[model samples]
Target chain A: MLYLGYCRHCGAGLLGLRRCGQGHLLVLCDECDALWQTSDLGQPPQFPPQPDLPCPHCGQSLNGPTAHWASLDEVRQAGWNDALIVGPGGCSAASAT
Target chain B: MRPGRRSVGLTLLGFGVLLAWLVVKPMLPTGPVETGQVRPETPNAGPPASVERPDGAAEQAERPVERPIDSAAGALTELPGDVWRSPGGLLYGPGSREGHRLRHVLRHARDDPDRPGEHGVFDGDQAAIVALIDEAYARSEQGAGRVERDGPRSVVTVDLQRRVGYVGGQVGRRQGHPATRHVRLVLEGRNVITAYPLRP
Candidate 1:
């Protein structure tokens, strides 16, 4: 868990942050789940890690700046809703809930 | 003054009392755990000890005796056939922790990410625990949540309990189920293969 200082949303001291199902960095107050949303990504990337995945839309391997998949907001802003965003296959979560 | 007036007045009084009780109930929390729900005890936190035992000839015997019979022998056999018999949860590997924590964090009345192959890498047991969780929530198409691997093995420790028990990091749906579903698959270690049900 990377220390990200205080949560901007809750003002609670943040010891860490994680990506929620929606691809948002969910800042957690783990004891009580006073969740905070932050735009500032923290401590670079570590843990299970950001995969070197390909964009289902561009059909090209994600590299350099595009390593992580774009959020729904970014996708929409780019007018790429119709693009086929691929799951993180191989490392993709198989249990599709 | 009339008989009908008295009857109506009594009915109104009862309704007022019922409404007042509803507003008051929120303030009266009996304890942290709800009344009907079972309270999950933190394995470490139990009866408070008033004083530390004095070091003496008695300490040797007392310490050994104080330890639970099941735990003292944990090092000998980590994956016993019936692990459910133990009271405390085991330490799960990073992989299993990610697998279990992933779903519990994601699946909600929110954006539903589909969990696939939950049975494979999802938390359950050091052996085939992921396969078990997957089978339980095999209906991944439900758009509940996703399961991801954090390490090589499903490292969650499990304890034998009546309620769903946590394996390394996730709970196994297999230990007990009125209905059981099994699937055949090839996993990490070829020597450690087994058919785990979709649900316990």
Candidate 2:
């Protein structure tokens, strides 16, 4: 399903959540040239390279997995919880109640 | 034959009685009369207000008062659904995650500029309730966002950022990072009962 929200990096008020071919969720921030996995099941899903799209924050072209995938460890290191990638399927790390 | 004196006297007495009756009618007490259609007691106009009764008792009376919008809004436990594990700062349900109504609410607020205090959920407005789960992850960083049940309603409060404020009496600390742009949401089942933003 497509979910819309804000892009913190560029403060753009839209972001979309879509599943790639492998059934993994991906979040693409077009304004920021950022595409990342919402799920961490396998290697983060790859999107077709967009050489023309430049990261709004750093002006880096988002063309490969190295530049686009948000590692699960990196997210955790940044102080984020594990719910994003786990989907609703059942991630036991945190309970929202 | 001319009217006898007795007949004329009797006629004068009857006229006097009629005049007396007219004068006294207005003076009589007209007790409360029931209208067959009882005006349904106008439902309390607004929030109940505290009023002083003649017996020196405090009572709740219906009055139009601008109820001070509470910064805390309402409790969370009132929401329809059983407590479920809060996953990734988003509270999920008595049912499956997709079926959880609150998921749409938090997502909608991510882009919604207008902070509607309390709102009802309509089928057509489901778009207003969608939030990107990825971004929700970023916002909940540093324990800044939280979702929990307050009563029957679910309360979701998120602190947008950490702020620096000067402290006065702390023996060792001179400054502290305060939470800023805190948004509290009170939800009932599938609807947003009220969303309050409180900054400390």
Candidate 3:
């Protein structure tokens, strides 16, 4: 339930549909990561952060929100599309912050 | 005066004159390089009698022109996912922002009225295609593009910066839905003469 504020891609706060490496809204987000691909799980889930993953395409550090934990294949597959992260359990009160 | 000494004195005098000439020449400013009054270089290899003739190499065995080292070097002749023809530019969707961007991307390229338009979705697979078009558009600041239907899907071709460019595949619906058509852009000359779109 921990509130993770990150731009999903650059770990930078969402830049209103952030421009990917190609300077286009390849993957964008609004109102937090809400505009990003939304996860379908009714409850929020918890995932560990891997701060070491740098995007191969743009060398941007990847240590942000749960959705930011995407691999190159996944990112490439979802060109300009936001990542959807839904967990089974609801966001814990402590994590919701 | 001894004849042998006189001869030796004359030799010394000549040497001194030559030394003085060398020293004065070094002190004087040298003029422009005059290669024998600028003769015309011809495979005819003969020196031209006239110095006034234009020396431009108009007729000569030419070497094959090499591509630019920055990008034209090791250029990709063809890509796998292609859908449309364009001069090379940005690919925008049907939305207003995207539309404006589309217009911006198309400013440099010309359209191929003869080639019928096709449509396809901008699937992630076609990112390369979009990237290619964007590159071209960036180069020319203008491009030609079109939107069409590929079967039940849709596709778009943005030719912005070059001549004889193309993109292919299907693109359907807007975001929130999975993009379908494969997008691509091929390079050509300074303008876009034609484009071809592929269907899903």
List ranges where model 1 is wrong by over 4 Å: A1-70, A76-81, A85-97, B1-91, B95-180, B183-196
Model 2 ranges off by over 4 Å: A1-97, B1-144, B160-180
Ranking by lDDT: 2, 3, 1
TM-scores of the models, in the order given: 0.20, 0.19, 0.16
Query: What interface-residue Cα RMSD does candidate 1 give after superposition?
Result: 22.0
**Least well predicted 10-residue stretch by lDDT in candidate 3 chain A:** A45-54
Task: Compose the digit string of candidate 2's lDDT tens values, residues B1-200.
Answer: 36798899989999999999999999999986542222211211332233323221221131212211111211123223433222223433321111123332223222221212111111112121222221233354445577665334444566644321111112112223122344444444433333323332
B83-103: candidate 1 lDDT, tens digit per residue: 221112222111111122221
Candidate with maximal lDDT: 2
Question: Each prediction's DockQ?
Answer: 0.01, 0.01, 0.01
Superposed Cα deviation of residue B137, candidate 3 (Å): 1.9
Better of 1 and 3 by lDDT: 3
After TM-score superposition, the amount by which residue B46's alpha carbon in candidate 3 deviates from its true location, in angstroms, is 63
Q: What is every candidate's alpha-carbon RMSD to the true fold?
A: 21.8, 23.2, 22.3
Residue B96 CA displacement from its true place in model 3, Å: 23
True C-alpha contacts between chains kept, each model in order: 0.00, 0.00, 0.00
Measured by TM-score, how close is model 1 to the native structure? 0.20
